[model samples]
Every structure is written in structure tokens, then in C-alpha cells.
Target: MDYLSIANGRVLYILASIVIIVVIIQSVLFLRMSWKRGISIGISKTKLKETVKTSAFFAIVPSIPIVIALIAISPVLGLPFSWMRLSVIGSQSYEMIAAKIGASSMGIANLTDPGYTAQVFSNSMWVMSVGIIWGLVLSIFALKKYQNRMKIVQKKDSKWAEIMVNALFFGMLSVFFGEPIVSGGLSLLVLLSSAAIMLFITWIAKITGKQWIRDFALSVSMIAGMAFAILFSNLGAV
Candidate 1:
């Protein structure tokens, strides 16, 4: 039946298309919301919808790059090692993340098993969903408590953080799913592109006149670091 092979190919195409489409849509919405509101609206309905869409799209999009990178690396390291290497990078992810959060590092060990990728993916999906809801709830609470000026900053930070967390979880999910789609030089190209996107997001957020821009800066760095780690471990010269 070649079920494993067939299923893997299907997943590659499905996830790739969904991730690309969602990212494009989210980017357009982001530009539109920023242009229209100019950091004034506390929370526009249009912006809210865009944020939600971006959050949902980001929840899984980050995984696509890793999945594709692994697929690309599968030839060099075989199926499972490519996946294990990705997880190893994630093991130290929380350490750097904790440091950013002003907390002591929490050493997370790599599961490093082929079967573990699926479990990690499942866990990430659950966590991302929960975080999105929590972030939204917190944003509402902040908006009510803070003044209008603060609300604008708070809203943007909240949405940006929500998207970052979603991206983080999706990156981890890629480790769990363990599908490879790219290889050779193409793999490296994709990894660099992913990093460029993350960097661009950080740069844009920082340059904006908004006050809470710093909050998003660190979060973007954290998310970028996590994704880069996975990409490097899986794609680096392998």
C-alpha cells in the first residue's frame, strides 16, 4: 500500500499550501490594519478579525517550514534522524525563551525519537490553541483596565504575542510530524527565507511609533530563535 509514503506526500502538499495561503492573507491583513488604524484604534473589528485570522493561520504555519526542511534533509540523514535533530534544537529552545522572560533557564531535553514527533505536534496544537484564547482574554481585560492610549499599545502587543506563540507551537509541531519535503541547496534557501521573514517582522514592529513595540520585539526574537534552531539542526550541512 505504501501508506507511509503516500500519507507523507499528502501531508507535505496540504500543509505547504495551507501555510503559504494563510501567511499571504495574514500579511495583507496586517498591512491593511496598520495602514487604516495608524496605531489609533483600540481594537477595530477589522483588526480583530485580522488578528484572529493571523493567529489561527500562524498556529500551524510555522510547522510547515520545519516539515519541509526535514523532508529536504531526509535524504542525507534518513527519515528519523532528520526529525530527531529538529527536536534536539527545541530542547534548548525554552532555555533561551526563559532568559528572555527574565526567568532562569529551564533545561528541556530532546525526546529525539521518530515517534515522539507526533506527540510533540499534538502537544503543540493543544498549547497553541490555549495560548491564543488566553491571550485574547487577557487583551480584553487589559483594554478594560488600561486607558485608551495604553489600550492601543496593549492590543498590538497582545496580537503580536499571540501570533508569535502560535508560530512557536507550529514550529514544534513540525518536529512531531517529521515530514521532509526539501533538500540540497533548496533547503538552505528556505531556512534563510524563514529567518528573513522573522527579522522583517521584528524590524517593522520596532520601527512603528507604537510604545509597546519592545514587547513584540522580544517575542519575535524568541519565536525566530526557536524556528531557526529547528531549521539549523535539521538543515545545517546535513
Candidate 2:
């Protein structure tokens, strides 16, 4: 009857599991098709295998942050909803803000508060769902058009187009890099430590030609950051 109970119910877990299974199936199918296409295009088996290995390594790095996000959201949204949202559509920051807005609309302080009822949970779900729907809609309908426009721009001036793309990426990275500074204290330390670790790993990779270390540098840096966070917290540095 309550939000917590409904959020953690077996039925929800079953549904979430189904969604995850479907995603896994789709991913496997895509991978298989891509591999076959690579071979058909005259790509060697050795190169294809290396591509797969590199992709898996790169995937592990981003996935660590997603897993961390899942843990952060699970306490409020419960495992089922958190898993599904993060796995399906929402990023950690977006999902949290959406949930907060949803709860606030119902006059609740936060997801974990005593006043967070079933209705509040429903509101949060709706907000989170609707918040992310626009992105999907754009991807489905407008992404190709946007990409085609970019392609034209690239064709006109390849170097400028590359610079534009890099600028966009840098802008996005700036927001994340600046976030810890605004948060201050332990967060800032963690961010700096992560950056330092990543840089060090990159340097080592370049010097020693350790391709595997370069491939997994992001994940190692993230883990190092998380460890530093814990250390700082325990030391009352935050």
C-alpha cells in the first residue's frame, strides 16, 4: 500500500528483470551483426577481435559510473525502478533531479522522507518518464536530420567540423569537471584525484605502450576517485 513496499515489490523486480533481459538480447544481436558485417567488409578476424576487446574495455569504464549512480538512487527509488531507469533512459543527475521535482510537486521534501507516499512515488515515476521522453522522441525523429546536417558541414570543412565536435565534447566535460569545484571539499578532492589518476595512467600507457592500461584507465581512475572519497570522508576532510 505504501511507496516503499510498492517500489520494492516482487512484481516490479520481475518487470525490471524482463527489461534487462530484452536489452541484453538486443545488444548480443547487434554485436553479432556488427561482427559479421566487419568480416564481410574485409576486416580481418584479428582486428575484429581487438575491436571487440577494446570496446568491452571502454564499456567497463562508463559502466562503473552507471553502477555507482544506481547505488546512489536505489535507496530512494528502490532497486527495481533505479535499475530500469538508469538502464533504459535516465542519467544519474537527470533522474535524481526529476525524482526531486516529482516529489516536490506533491509537497514532499524528498524521496526518503516520511511523507513520501504511494502517490508521491507515482508522481516521481511520471516526472522521470516524461522528462526523458523528449530525448527519445528527438533521437527517433530528428537525430538523422541533425547528423546529416553535421555531415554536410563536415564535408564542407573537415577540420572545422572536427574542431566543432571537439568543442561540444569539451563543453559537456566542463560542466562535469566544474561540478566538484562547486560542491567543494571531499568532492573536489575526489575529482582532482580522479583526473590526476587518469593523467598518470595515460602517461604510463604512452611511455610503456601498455594498450590494456589505456583501455581501462577511465575505470581505474573512477575507482581511485571513489576510494579517495571514502578516505576523505573517514578523515573528516569533507
Candidate 3:
């Protein structure tokens, strides 16, 4: 069977389009509700509009990665599923890893190889969808209790609670930072370079009082880091 046909079929496109439309509708509804609530609570319309503009700008910067992710995985999973998965819930790392596992489990050595089949695609889809839910399930069942406990801790020892919260935040970030550092090489170099670029951009933003430059910091840093990576690789620096 031509699995790519099914993967990129009109049916899949329709399904993905529907899901995307629903998400957009929900976002619009939430924005309208929040805007109205803010106005009711005495937020000036000018301030609210500025907040929305800033938020939309930040949102686009983050989605640059997601667009790249969609392009990266589309060959393996096809455009529709990859588009839906990345647009909805799955990250690039998770989707790629899950798809690789699924394909390899079926004895496929290369996902983008021409011999990929419908069975492998189906299995990868299932794994990608199911694997993302365990953490969400834990949160649904336990997050409320955990939050209540944190509230109690905050009331009893505000400073300690703040420390604990910061620790947890950093712990969550450790996963993102740990991988590049462990890989050591271009990954580490790029990571450090991006950090430096972000700091430099931030300093410029502060010195110049340009809020828009601060808003562009992460996106600019990432692109510059990629350019440096290519230059380093060409120079045999990995």
C-alpha cells in the first residue's frame, strides 16, 4: 500500500483542517471573553489593545519553531498528521522520537525511506497520541491537590514557598537545557551562543528602551545561532 497517499490524503487534510479551525475558534472566543472581562474590570481599551499586540507578537516568535518542526517531520508522517500533531499538542522532539520508535518497531530503519507502510504510520500515530497523555492524566488527577498543598505551604512560609516554586520552575526547565549540554558540540555551542545573543539583545532593549526589540530577542537569537552553527560546521568546528 502507498502509505504516503493515505497520510497526505484529502481525508486527512480535511480532518486536520477541522481541528485547526476549532482551535482558532476557541482562541477567538477566549480573546473576546477576556477582552470584555478586562473592560468590565476597568482596564483601559488602549492598554488592552497594546497587551493583545504584544501577546500576538510573542506568539508568532514561538511558533517559528513549530513551523520548522512541521516541515522537519512532514516527510516522515506526511503533512496533515504532522501539521495537526505539532499544531495541537506534540513537540518536535516528542513527535520525532515517537515516530522513530513506531517505524523502527516495524523493522523500518529509516522513517523517510520510500518503503514506509500504512501499518507503520498507523502505529506511529497511535504512539504519538497516547504517549502525550500520561502527564496530562497525572495533572488532571493530582494537580489540584498539589496546588492546595502549595497554598498551605505559601501561607505558612512565604519565602520558603517562593523558593520551592522557583526550584520547580527550574527543574521543569532542566529537561530543555539538559539535552543540548549532554550532546556537547554544536548543540552546546549553539545553546550558549543563543543565550549570549538573547542577553545582548535584552541589554540593547534596556539601553534603547525599545520594547519591540526585546520582543524580537528570542527569535533573532535563534536565527543568529543557526547561522553561527552553519558557519562553525563549514569551518570543521562541528
Which candidate leads in lDDT?
Answer: 2
What 10-residue stretch in candidate 2 is worst by lDDT? 53-62
Kindly provide the TM-score of model 3 when superposed on the true structure, using C-alpha atoms: 0.73
**Can you write out model 1's per-residue Cα lDDT over 96-192, one digit (the tens) per residue?**
2322222111122433323333334334334433433555577778866656765565577988766866888999967733433434353454445
- How much lDDT does each candidate structure score? 0.50, 0.88, 0.86
Model 3 lDDT vs. the true structure?
A: 0.86
What is the per-residue lDDT of model 3 for residues 1-238, given as tens digits with 9 covering 90 to 100?
6898999999999999998899889889999999999999999997787676666765775688889988899987899999998887677778888888888888888887766789889988888878888887989999999889989999999999989889999999888889888888988888899899999999999999987787667778877888889988899997
Instruction: Judge candidate 2 at residue 191 and give its lDDT.
Output: 87
**Clash count of each predicted structure:** 7, 0, 0
State how far residue 165 of model 2 sits from its true place (Å): 1.4
Rank the candidate models, highest lDDT first: 2, 3, 1
Q: Model 2 clash pairs? A: none
Worst 10 residues of 3 by lDDT: 52-61
Task: Compare candidates 1 and 2 on lDDT and give the better one.
Answer: 2
